[model samples]
Target: MLTINNLHARIEEKEILRGINLEIKPGEVHAIMGPNGSGKSTLASVLAGREDYEVTEGSVTFNGKDLLDLAPEKRAAEGIFLAFQYPVEIPGVTTINFLKTAINEIRKYNGQEPLDAAQFLKRMREKAKLVKIDDALLKRSLNEGFSGGEKKRNEIFQMAMLEPTLGLLDETDSGLDIDALRIVAEGVNQLRDGKRSFVVVTHYQRLLDYIVPDFVHVLYKGRIVKSGTKELALELEEKGYDWIKNEVDALEIA
Candidate 1:
């Protein structure tokens, strides 16, 4: 569903995401794990069409179209959903209201009719249950005063509501306890129908325990250095990223 080839990106002259090469087919889940300053989040931001990062070289194709060519909202309309590492609070916008507007806007972009208030409410209730989001939270401002766990879960809730073809979860596991992690993973698992794809970016192996990936990729210094199955995550957890660093250093020395 998504192909990134030699993807290079930079922010303010500092290169990030140097020669990232990944290919994800439909119905597959790929986990990207790396340490700090490894360009994991940079890959997510570039894929989501964040304007701050400029693509210096390389190409990304999503469903046969040039993904890098589309704007951020256009990327969303085309079925790319990015769950941020830190969900921002919109103090005045209630969750339900914001979701309503977003859903309708997405539908409009896709040439679908907007859901009526009753239909929207019904769908909202259904999706809310999927994420274990309560009605009280729905009534509150978006992410405003929500605990860290709540904000992360809220991102999953947004993903559930959007039902994107490809979901890019940028460290959704951050700050979440086991319970909150399970809640978010269950939501993601519930939505996994063997047709949608997910690229899960995280540093810990614990999250992979819940949302087991088809492939685990080790990213370092803005590039993917290793790819393997879930067992690779376990190895990384046991041995730490130093192994990966050593391997890359060996290759460079050779």
Candidate 2:
């Protein structure tokens, strides 16, 4: 559902992503793994239309429309959901209110009538139960004083509420415990159907054990150096990224 071609992005005159080319189809899950400063997160931010990054070249097309040409909110309305590594804390906004605002905003953008309060609350309770998010937690201020695991679960809860066509999960497993990870992964898995896709960006392979990406891509120095199935993730976890880097360097030199 998403196609990126020769993508180049920079922040404050410093380049991050260089010639990133990836194509994601519906119902497919792709995992991007790389060490620090390898531009994995940068790719996610650029794709989500974060204003700080400047796209110098390349084009991203989502569902036959030019994605880069749209604003960030417009991108969300087009069915892109990005789960940030650090979810922001809005002290005055309850989680339910924040989510309701987001859902209504998206609906307005998509030309759909806004959900009534009763309908919205009904859907909220159902999705919250689906993600196993406690009703007590949803009543609190958004991410305010929440534990790391709670924040992560809240992110997945939001995802379940929005039901975006494409989900970009960036470092979702970073601060999650095993229990939280499983819950989040279950939420993601439940949403995986023929009409949705996911790009999971992470450094370690542990998250892949639960998500089981259809494709695993090794990103290095701003580009994907290798792409394979879930087996590649296992091999990387066993042999480390240095081995993959050496192999890639050898192939380039050959």
Candidates' RMSD to native: 0.9, 1.3
Worst 10 residues of 1 by lDDT: 122-131
What lDDT does each candidate get? 0.93, 0.91
TM-score of each candidate structure, all chains considered together: 0.98, 0.96
Candidate topping lDDT: 1
In candidate 2 the C-alpha lDDT for residue 11 amounts to 96
Residue 38, candidate 1: Cα error in Å is: 0.8
- Candidate 1 lDDT over residue span 134-246, tens digit each: 88998999999999989988899889888899999999998988899999999999989999999999999999988989999999999999999999999999999997899
What is the alpha-carbon lDDT of model 1 when measured against the actual structure? 0.93
> What TM-score would you give candidate 1 relative to the actual structure?
0.98
Candidate 2 on 22-130: residue-level lDDT in tens?
A: 9999999999998788899999999899999999999999999999999998999999999998999999999999988999999999999999999998989888876
Clashes per candidate (backbone, < 3 Å): 0, 0
Candidate 1, residue 168: lDDT: 96
Off by over 4 Å in 2: 249-254
